[model samples]
Target: MTEPPFELEPIGEVRTPFETSDEAPRQGLEGEEPTHGEIVLAPAFEPGLEGIEDGETVDVLWIADEADRSVLRVRDGERGVFSTRSPHRPNPICVTTCRVRAVDGRRLAVSGVDMLDGSPVVDLKAPLE
Candidate 1:
């Protein structure tokens, strides 16, 4: 049976210092220092931020808009796309856990972000402990 199509509307956008994939760390906390970024939620979604607080960890789901969606393998074909964390996949969705540094209105100051600047934030939720 064919599956129905679905669409995702971004609840927010992330602001980071990395402009390109090469500039971003492979993982959120892999660099020498944890990178800081901000998630600016749309005014309509601000109400959903009620319970989140500083020091909490959240799972951030975002789209790798600049990634090559056609890449099916990496590392000289040593691994399939599904076996790796390559951003270049059929669906370039990426997930990372970030610490909530602060929350001011609709903007969340977070650390440990590895996404590129201006990445669309699909969703954010508390990670399973």
Candidate 2:
């Protein structure tokens, strides 16, 4: 197999209450209340958070480090990995849309998180128009 063309370095990490996959919701909005979390960006990436206002929605791209990367089918074996939101794929890069509750220096307070604590955040972007 050919090697990947590039490498990904985490610019930050997601801080959530979930310590294990079982503790996390399947989706960000799955629970009765939107899960709250924080994106703690590295000092070098702090400047990139400029102009990101409170109440704005953004896409957070992160690595599912705890995912089972060898699986290509859903747990029920009824659908292919690509056809489902299953994190158990060749590359466990995941994205979730979250609302910014607050922004303080290198930390962003957000809601609608499904990720576990300390998940490496690859990038953050405004939702595509």
Candidate 3:
């Protein structure tokens, strides 16, 4: 079978200490779970991040941007593709959430990151009511 084609235009890049996926936590934006990473949004999104505030965490949807998409099944092999935090085998796409640490004009300093360095950010939104 022939794989279909797809295209992706990176909106911006993220910076974090997670140099390798092996070091990355099992969960994205573990929040209070104990992680020391941040997300730096592009300057163009400053106006959009106006609503975010300190302690007001928002979900940062990002692309793994560095993971391989050939492996599936959980480590214990006890769950289906639609169950649990098994994004390790996503369809070449990855998403994560981060807490809005601080917003300085167009620069967003956030924590609770689980993505690799220089990852691609797709979308971000404050938690819905």
Clashes of each: 0, 0, 0
Q: Compared with the true structure, what per-residue lDDT tens digits does model 1 show for residues 4-102? A: 466889999999999988899887766789999999999999999999999999999999998899999899988899999889998999998999999
lDDT of 3 by residue, 8-27 (tens): 56656678778887777776
The collision pairs in model 1 are: none
Span of ten consecutive residues with least summed lDDT in model 2:
1-10
Backbone clashes in candidate 1 total: 0
RMSD (Cα, Å) of model 2 = 2.3
Q: What is the C-alpha RMSD of each candidate to the true structure, in Å?
A: 2.0, 2.3, 4.0
Model 1 residue 46 CA deviation in Å:
0.6
Ranking by lDDT: 1, 2, 3
Error of 3 at 78 (Å): 4.8
lDDT-superior candidate, 2 or 3: 2
User: What overall lDDT goes with each candidate model?
Assistant: 0.92, 0.92, 0.68
Q: Which regions in candidate 2 have their CA more than 4 angstroms from the true location?
A: 1-5
lDDT against true structure, model 2: 0.92
lDDT minimum window of 10 residues, candidate 1: 1-10
TM-score of 3: 0.74
